[model samples]
Target: MASTLHDVARLAGVSIKTVSNVINDYPHVRPATRERVEQAIAELGYTPNLTARSLRSGRTGAIALAVPELGLSYFAELAASVIEAAEEAGVVVLVEQTGGDRDRELELLRSPRLKMTDGLIFSPLGMGQDDVDRLDVPYPLVVLGERIFDGPADHVTMRNIEAARAATEFLLRTGRRRIAIVGAHEGEVIGSAGLRLRGYREALDAAGVPFDESIIGYTTLWHRSNGARCMRELLDRGAEFDAVFGLNDTLALGAMRVLQEAGLRVPGDVAVVGFDDLDEARYSIPSLTTIDPGREWIAATAVRTLLERIEHPDAEQPARLLLADFRIAERESAGAALDSASAALESAGAILHQGAGADA
Candidate 1:
C-alpha cells in the first residue's frame, strides 16, 4: 500500500531515474526538478526504502555517533548539531552514550551494532593517548575530543590551550589579579583539565602574575554540583580571589549561584568566566561570558569528513587533525572589559578558520 519511486516520478512529471537522483542527493540534479520530486514525496508521505537503496548504492545511508554522556549540555547540543547536519545530507544518525567509562568505550568500538552504519564519529573521554590503537576500526571513523590524539583515524577538536588562555587573559584585563579556577583535576597533564589549566597558567605568566595554587578548586567531574561544592570549599578555606574561571559554563553558573548565596555581587565584587558557550549561558542571570568553541562547525565538519571517508574508502590520504577556532562570547558576567579584548583580537586579524595539522 506504500507509494513507490515510480509513483513519485509520475506525480512529479519526471522519469524514475530523475526521482532516484534527487532521492540519493546527487549534486547534478536540476534544482527545480529536485524541488518537484521533494514536493511529491511530501504530498504522498513517501518513505525511503533504505534496505533496497543500500543494496544498490553499497552504503547503509546511516552513520553512528558516540559521545560521552548526553546528560551534559555540551554533548547534547553537539549531538543535536550532528543530527541536523546528517539530515541535511539525507542520512540517518544512530547515537550512543558511553558514560565516559573506559571499558564501555572499548566495548563500543567493537560492538556489532555499528555494522548497520557506514561510518562513526567517536568522542571518548576515559580513553587516553596510550589506547589509540583501538580507534583503528575497519569502518570510516572520525575522532572527536581531547582524550586521544594522533590516532589512526582523522581527529577533530578545539584549540583547548589557546581558548582557555584567552579566557584567563579576559579576566586579567578586567583588573582581577587573584583569579580562582573551578573543575581542575590535580596531577593531570593531557585531558581537557590539563590542557585548559596549562592555558590559564600561560596567561598568568604572560601578564606577570604569580601562579598561586591555594585558590585552585580541584574536582573529579565538571558537573554543576561539583562546581557548587568546589566554590563552597574555597569559601570555607578563605581563599582570596577577585575572580573565578570555571572550566565550563555549568561550573561557572554553579559558582555564580554560590557567590550570590554568600552575598557577593557578580562583576561588582567578583567577575566570572566559563568555557563552552552553552545555550543556558545566555539565559542565566547577568548572563555568562564564555568561550564559543565553534561547536556547530565542529559537528558539521565531523559529519562531512566521515562521509568523505565513507564515499571514498580507498583514498590514500593520511589521517588529519582538524582544529576549530574559538572566540570569547562577551556577556554581562565578565564585565565591560571584554569589549576591548574582542577589539584587540579583531584588530590582530583573528579570522575563524579550521586549520589542518600535520598528518599523523
Candidate 2:
C-alpha cells in the first residue's frame, strides 16, 4: 500500500496542511518543520498526488529554463547544473533552446506554454538592452547571461569584466606581450563580447600596453568553429602576436587547435588562455588556463531565486542583480616562464652529467 499524506503528517508530527506546505516548497515553512516533513517523506516513501495537487494549487511544480544553444559547452554545463538544483527542490525542469535568435527570444517571452510552469529562467543572446520592455510580462521570471541589463526581473550572472581582465593580466604576467583576442563582435556594446573586451582593455591600460586594433579577431559566434575561423583570419592577416585569449574555453580550444595545426607550438610559439573554465579546458593539450566564474553557484542561486519567486509571487522583493565571483584556474596553457627556465637548466645539467660519466 502507498503511504498517504496523512501518514507522513502523523510521522512528522504536523498538520496535513503543514505537510502539504513543505511538499510544495513553501518558503515560509520553518526550517526545522520542513526538515521533519522531508525526513518523514523519506522514511515512509510518501509521494504526493501531483495531478490532484496541481488542480488545487494551480502550479505545475515545474519551471522553464531557456538558453541560447545547448551546443555551446558553457550553456550545456549550466543547464546540467540547473537540473541538479531543481531536482534538490523536488521540482522538474523543461529546457528550451532559443538558438539565440532575437525573434525567437522575444516570442518565448510571450509564449502561452509558460503557463505550464511555475516560472522561467531565461538566458538571452540575441536580445539587447533596449528590449528590456519585452520582459515586462505577468509571469515570474529570472534573467541570466550578460545581455539586456536593467530589465524587469531578478538577474543572475558572473562577473565578466573583472574575470576577463584577470585572464588578460595573467597572460601578460607570463612574459607574453602583444596578445591577440578571439571572438570580437562588431559594434557590441553591453553584450558579453563587449564587456569582456572592455576588461581586456582595462588590463592592458593598467599594464601600460598599447592597444592595437589589428590583433583583434572578429567573430559573430563563440562556437569552436568560430574560434578556429577567427584564428585563421588573424593568421591570414599576418598579425604579430605572442599570446592569444579566447573569450571562452570552446573558442580557446578551437584557436589552440588552429595554432598547433599551423605549426605554432603552444607556450613555445604563443601562449593561450581562455574564459569559462569548462570541464574540457582541464584536459586539453597544454591544459587551458581559464576563469572559474561561479557557474555552479549561479545555477543553484537562479533555481532557488525562481523557486522563491514562485513561493511568494506577491512579495515586495525588489529585482536584484547578483554577480557571481570568479577566479583563474592556473594550467599549462598559461605557461610559466620561470618553470620552463628551471626545467631547461635541469635538462642541460642531466645531459652534461651523463657525458662526463661516459667519458670517465
Candidate 3:
C-alpha cells in the first residue's frame, strides 16, 4: 500500500492540515515546519492523490497549453520545453493544437475542457486585438504572441520587431544590398509577420536604401512550403535581389533550397539569413545564420507565470509583459566566404612565420 498523508503527518509530528498546507505550497507555513513536512513526505514516499486533492482544492494537477500549431519546429520545441518545466513543478500538461485557424482558435477559447485544468498558456495566431475582451474568462491565463498586447493577462513573447531589425541590419553590414524579405503578411499590422516587415523597413530606411515593394514576398503562412512557394513566385516576377531574409528558419531553409534549384550559389549569388535558431538550422547545407530568440526562457517563464497565478489567485494580476532577448547565430550561410578567406589568410601567415623561424 502507498503511504498516505496520515503517515507524513505522523512522521513529521504535525497535524494532517499542516502537511496538506506544505504540500500545497502555502506561503504562510513556517520554514522549519515546511521542511519537516517535506522530509516526512520524502521518507514515507507519500504521493498525494491528485483526485482527492482536486476535490478539496478544486485544482487539477495539470495545466493546459494551447498553441497555433506544433507542426512548426519552433512551437514543437516550445511545447517540449513547457512540458519539462511543468514536470519539475510536479504538474502535468494537456496540450491542444488550434491549426492556426481563427474559428478553431476562438472555439478553443470557450472550451469546456479548460475547466479540467488549473490554468492555460495560450499562444494565439488567429485572434487579434478585437478578441482581447473575450479572454476575460474564469480560468487563470497567460497569453503569448504579439497579436494582442496590453491584454488582461500575463504576456510572454519574443521581441519580434527588434530582433528582426537586428537580422536585417546584419545583412546590410555584410554589404548585401537589394535584400528580399520572405514571409511578409499582405495587410497585417500587429502580428509577427507585420512586426518583422516593419523592422526590415526600418533597417533599410536607416541605411538610406530605398524600399522596393516588389522585392517583398507575401505569404499567408510562415511554413517552409510557404517560403519555397513565395521564393518561386518572386523569381518568376524577375525582381532583382542579392540576399533573402526569411521570417523564420524554416522559411529560410525552404527559400535556400529553391534558390539552389535555380542554380544560384548561396552567399555567392544570394546570401541567406533567417529567424528562429532551430536545431535544424545548424545542419542545413551551408548552415543558416539566424536569430536565437531566447525560446527556452520564454517557455520556462510562461509556465512559471501560469503556476504563480494558479497558486496565488488573490495576488494582484498586473498583466505583466515579458519579451525574450535575442541574438544572431552567425553561421556559414551568410558569411561562409568571409570565414574561409580569413582561415586561408591565417594559414598563409602561419607558413610565413614557420619559414622565418627556420632562417633565424
Candidate 4:
C-alpha cells in the first residue's frame, strides 16, 4: 500500500498543510519542524505524487532537449551527458532531432510539443544570429551551440575560438609548421566551424605564421567522411602541409585514415590533431590527440540554468552566457613529436607518408 500524506503528517505530529509546505520546499518552515517531517518521511517512505503536484503547480517534471542529429558522435555523447544530468536533478529529458534544417529548427521552437516539458535546451545547427528574435517564446528555454548569440535566453557553450587557437599553438610548439585545417564550413561566421577557424587563424598570427588559404579544407559537415574527402582534395591539389587540425574528432579521425592510406606516417609524416576529446580518441590504432571541451560541465550547467529560469518565469533578467573550459589531450596521433614512443617509430625508418594500408 502507498503511504499517504496524511499518514506522514500524523506520524510527524504536524498539520497536513505543514507537511505540504515541507514537501514543496516552501520557505518559512521552522528547522525543527522540517527535520521532524523529514524523519517521518524517511520512516513512512512517503514519496510526493509528482503528477498531482505538477497539475497544481502548472509544471511538468520533464525538460526537452533538441539537437541537430544524434547520429553524429558529438551530439550523441552530449545527449547522454545531458540525460545523466537531468536524472540527477530528478527530472526526465525528452529528446528531439531537427536534422540540422533551418525550417525544422524554427518549427521546433514554435511546436506545441514543448508544452509537455517544463523547458527546452536547444542546439540549432542551421539557425543564425538573425533568428534570435524567434526565441521570444512563452516557455523557458536555454540555447546551446554557437549558432545564435545574445538571445533572450541562457546560452551554454564552449570557447571554440580560444580552444581552437590552443590546439594550433600546441601543434606549433611541437615544431609542426605548415599545418592544414579540415572541417571548415564556407561563409560561416557565428557557427562553431567559423569560430574555430577564427581561433586557428589567431593562433597562427600569434605564432608569426602566414595564414595560407590553400591549406584550408572546406566541408559542409564535420563527419568522418567529409574529413576524408576534404583531405583527399587537399592532397590532390598538391598542398604541402606538415600537420593537420581537424575541427572535430570525427573529422580528424577521418582525415587521419586518408593520410595513412596515402602512405603518410601519422605524426611522423604529417602530425594530426582534432577537437572534442571523445571516448574513441584514445582507442584509435595510433590513438588521437584532441581537445576536452568541458562537455560534462556544459550539460550540468544547462540543466541548472533552465531550472532556475523555469522556477522564476516572471523575473526580469537578461540572457546569461556561460562558457565551458577546454584542454588539449596529448596522444600518439599528433605524431612522434607528441610522445617518445612515436619518436621511436620515426627512428625505425618507417616512411610516414607512404600510402594507406602500409602499416594500418
Leading candidate by lDDT: 1
Which ranges in model 1 have alpha carbons more than 4 Å from their true place? 1-48, 338-360
Instruction: Please give the distance, in angstroms, between residue 324's alpha carbon in candidate 1 and its true position after superposition.
Output: 0.6
Q: What is the full ranking by lDDT, best candidate first?
A: 1, 4, 2, 3
List CA RMSD, all candidates: 5.2, 10.8, 9.3, 8.1
Candidate 4 at 243: error in angstroms? Answer: 0.4
The TM-score, computed over Cα atoms with residue i paired to residue i, of candidate 2 is 0.82
Q: Between the candidate structures 3 and 4, which one is better when assessed by lDDT?
A: 4
lDDT of 4 by residue, 1-360 (tens): 888789999999999899999988999999999999999999999998877777888999899999999998899999999999999999999999999999999999999988889999999988899999998888999999999999988899988888888788778867888999999989887788999999999999999999999999999978899999999999999999999999999999999999999999887889888989899999986899888887888999899889989999999988888888777777888745655654675455422221111110
- The 10-residue segment of model 1 with minimum total lDDT is 350-359
Error at 81, model 2, angstroms: 0.3
Top candidate (TM-score): 1
Backbone clashes per model, in order?
0, 0, 0, 12
TM-scores, all candidates, are 0.84, 0.82, 0.82, 0.82
The 10-residue segment of model 3 with minimum total lDDT is: 351-360
Residue pairs with colliding backbones in model 1 are: none
Candidate 3 residue lDDT tens string, 83-184: 999999999999999987778988988899988899999988888989888778778999988898888888888888878887887777667889999999
Q: Candidate 1: what lDDT?
A: 0.89
Model 4 segments beyond 4 Å from truth?
Answer: 1-49, 338-360
Model 2: lDDT equals 0.87
Q: So what's the TM-score on candidate 1?
A: 0.84
Better of 2 and 4 by lDDT: 4
